[model samples]
Target: MFGRIGRTSVKHPWLTILAWVVAAFALVALAPALKSTTDQADFLPSHYESVQVGKVQERAFPEQDQPASIAVFWRDDNGPLTDGDKADVAKVTESLDKAGFNLVKKIETSPEAVSPNGKIALASVVASVKDPYDEKLLESVKELRKKAAPLLEGTSLKMGLTGSAADALDSQESSGDTDAMIMMATLVLIIVLLGVIFRSPLIALLPVLIIGVVFMVANGLIATAAEVFGLEADASVSAILIVVLFGVGTDYILFLLFRYREALREGQAPKQAMSDAVANVGETIASAAGAVIVAFLALLLSSLGMLRAMGPALAISVAVTLIAALTLVPAIFSLLGEKAFWPSKAWRKQPKHTLGKRIGDLTARRPGVVAGVSGGVLAVLAAGVLTFHPTFDAGSSLPDDLESVVAMEKLQSGFPAGQTDPTWVVLEKTSDGKLEQAEVEAFEKKLAASGFGEVSPGVIGAGGDVAQFAVLLKEKPSSDAAMELVSGKLRDAAHDAAPEGSRALVGGLTAVFADIQTAVNRDYSLVFPIAGLAIMVILGLLLRSVVAPWYLMLAVGLGFGAALGSTVWLFQGLQGKDGLLFTLPVIVYLFVVAIGTDYNILMVARLREEVRRGQNSADAVRHSITHSASTIGAAAIILAGTFGVLLLAKNSMLQQMGFAVAFGILLTAFVMALLLVPAVTKLIGPRAWWPGIKSDTARPAEPGPLLTEAPAGDRASV
Candidate 1:
């Protein structure tokens, strides 16, 4: 099947190229732009208590004056606010409201807004929209800041905004041009690495040009899918998509190129070698991409809409890359023929006694020692997983020097840490009428006594059916402690202490984080196993052996643990961070489990090919490593380099993700695929193929040889 596709592509190279170009252009011009939402609630299902509370708020408090942001006012002299400063604060608030900023509803300040210690004054910046993270609202906050500087010119009061909207804006500004940085870094890394490896500028730059087109097509398709299906992507999707497409696309390109070069070295005609290249490596690439796609698709089981949306989106990208790899790559290379590696005559011959060959010989010579050492290293690193801690504080990922973060710190000096965002415990009538005063009082009292925090008096809506009580937690509202309080004791107290006629629901950012934590935990249990099982099935089908899939999966699983544990050790243990991003485990799992399998698949498939040629188990393992290791190493370095560019991002989440995925790729490529997998397979012997044996002694006829092992006439068809 693969041979047919390759032959057709090579025969009709121009037509194939034209088809891809036209399709990419059409999609780019016609597709709707992908939209993203920063609202945490949007990622949750409507069934979650936090989401339910949001719905109730919309119904019960339609005209609520919910502040989109808060302006913290302090004396420039760093002293208590005097009477003059408080009056100036009110004036500044009024002027900012009247500055004609879009989406600005009203900015209010009162005498009572002064802190008890007289050190600070507060102003609420309410928006016309409910979502504080709305882009327009963030724009309004930005404009308001500009307008305030002029208003406060003559007054002693200085003000800075700190709230959801302002924080989002600051985060956006702090990450300025980061996507450009990542793209540039990735391209430069790939170009440099490829140039160094192939010593051909054309070879280095061609994949970039090809993958660039593939990138646009993948993005257009993703956007069209999102538009048609009404999917909301998270803001981080664009950056992640860039890496995945380029990284994986380059990987597939290298796989084919290596085989093509090998066939050429055997002296086959250009087109024939290209065709044989596709036939030889096609199954391996397809199986590897299939494993990744299925693994990504497994995110459909995730409770969080973010992961659910991400799954299909990433799967679509890999699918496009796979198609391009099997078609466009071969078509273009077939036309270029030997010219693809122009200015470098090295492709005409093979290098001798290289590191890959040395390592391969070592592994085949002493499989047991190599397996024990590699496996032991992974196990020791896996121990760090026990210390893994998850944090939900999005603000912490932003630069501390940002205006919103600095303002938040200042606000905490005169108020509680949770003053910027308080948890809400609502009491509502189960039937229709307004909540009884006694019931509201009882719920508030119970909540305050629940050990979560101090609860404010109930604020009843105009409908009178619901009352909201703000809980100012002792910890920051986004802290792990706050989420724990909301998810555990606070929730139990609210549900259990509600009056007989009324019901209670806990809602707020902390509540949302708690719910997200629950959803992530659920996804870990559900999505990881499903993705792992699905990949194992792919491995089993590809190897035609159930026993081989089990050990391969175990190796990949161990690689994942090692990657995550190493990340946790660097961030939480060495760097003294409170915890990793709440979604770190998910990101690590997807990349490590899926991508890690790619290297393993390539190695095992090569091993199988050598075995089919009637080579002994040890020689097969040695030859597999010797021939496939350089390809794996080069691809791994490029992919890992692309991800490692994320370390350049100021956002800690991106940095952590970058390090984890990059390091994991290196570990999987070097330790697991190159050393451990080959060593273990060697130890397993012919039983590795168990029920589908194809050894020299077991098979009725000798299987086809690899291009390197085949006779000159047979090389064209191999």
Candidate 2:
């Protein structure tokens, strides 16, 4: 099947290239732009309490939809506000409301909102829209900020905005700016690294040029797929898509090019060598891509809608990359052949005692010791997973100097950290009719006395039967202490202290994060195992052996633990961070483990090929490592380098993700694939393919044919 694909692509290179170009342009021309949402409720199913609160708010108190944002006022002199300063707060609030801010209904300040110390006052700005995270509302907050600066010019109190709209505006700006940085860094890394590896400006630029087309096509397909399937994604997908497409695309191209160069060195005609390259490594690339696609598709089982959408979106990208790898890559390269590596005469002859050969010889000579040491190193690093702490504070992972974060910190100076974003408890009539003021006030007092903090009535709706109370916490909303307060005492008090005929529900950003924590924990138990099992199935099908897939997954599992553990050690232990991003484990498992499987598949497949071509187990290990090393090494370095570009971002999440992934790829390719997998397979002997006997007790190929080859005609194809 692979031979047929190679032959057809070789025979009709121009047509194949034209077909890809046409399809890419067609998709780009017709597909609508991809859309993403920032609404917290949108990320989870409707059943969660956080989501239910949003629905309840819309249905019950439509007027008190989320505050578009909050304006916090304090004396710029860092002292208590005089009565005149409070008057200025009211004056500025009224002026900002009248400033013609789009999407803002009206700004309101009250005596009750003033701190007891008289140093800080807050005015809640409500948006007219039900969805406060709407971009227009963020713009409204931006406009309101411009208006506030002028309004405060003669006042003693200074003002800053904090809350949903303000945070959204800041996040939009940060991510938007960082997107360009990440893309430029990625492209530069690919070009410079490829330039160094191939020593050809053309080859360095080729994958970038090709992947540019793949990016458009993949994005268009992903957008189309989302539209057709009703998949809702987050804004982060675009930047992520750029890295995945370029990184994976380059890896596939390098795999084929390395094989092509090998064929060229064996003296095959340019066109024939290209065909032979495709025929040999094509299945490996396909299987590698298949692993990634299926692993991503497994996110469909995720309870979170974000992953459900993201999983399929990324899966579509890898599928497109795979297609282009087998079809488009071969077609274009067939025409260039040896000229692809032009100006580098090294392609004409293989190098002697290459790093690959030395490593291969070491593993072949002492498989047991190599396996023991490599496996032991992975084991030692895996211990750090014991100290893993998951942080749901996505905002804290942002650059500290970002406006929203800075504003939030400034707001905290004169008020409770949670003042800008308070948790809400709602009491609703299980049936209908108005709630007695006595019962409502009684519930409020009960909540305050329970140490959940005092509550102020924010909205009374459903003819006074449904009521919402804003309860300010003492701690920052993103802190673990705050999560404990909300998920523990506040919720228990709310649920326990409801009026006779009413029920109470806690709702806020903190509650949302708490639920997200629960959702993530649930996903870890289900998603990781499911993705692992699915990948194992892919390996089993590709290798046609049950036993091999098990050990391969174990090696990849060890690699995953080591990757995550190292990140925890570096970021949490060494850097003294409170915790790493909660999503780190999931990200590491999917990209690192899944892609690691690709390297494992390539190496193991090569090992099997060497064994079948009449080499003993140890010699097959040597031969496989010697021949496939350059391909895996080049691909790993490029892929790892691409991810490393994320470190250029000031945001800690991207930095951590960059380091973990890049390190994991190198660990998988160099240590696990080269040392551990080969050593273990050599130790396992013929039974590694067992349940199915794929290798025979054939004579070993002369000690190092691949490392120090026989003549061109006599040597077998790599």
Best by lDDT: 1
lDDT of 2 at 542: 67
Give the residue spans of candidate 1 off by over 4 A.
Answer: 449-451, 694-718
lDDT of 1 by residue, 13-82 (tens): 9999999999899999999999898787899999999999988888888787778889999998889988
Off by more than 4 A, model 2: 130-156, 171-176, 398-403, 432-438, 499-501, 694-696, 699-718
TM-score to true structure, per model? 0.95, 0.92
Q: lDDT tens string, model 2, 549-621?
A: 8899899989999999988889988988888888888778766887767788888877766665687888888
- Candidate 2 clashing pairs? none
Clashes of 2: 0
TM-score for predicted model 2 compared with the true structure: 0.92
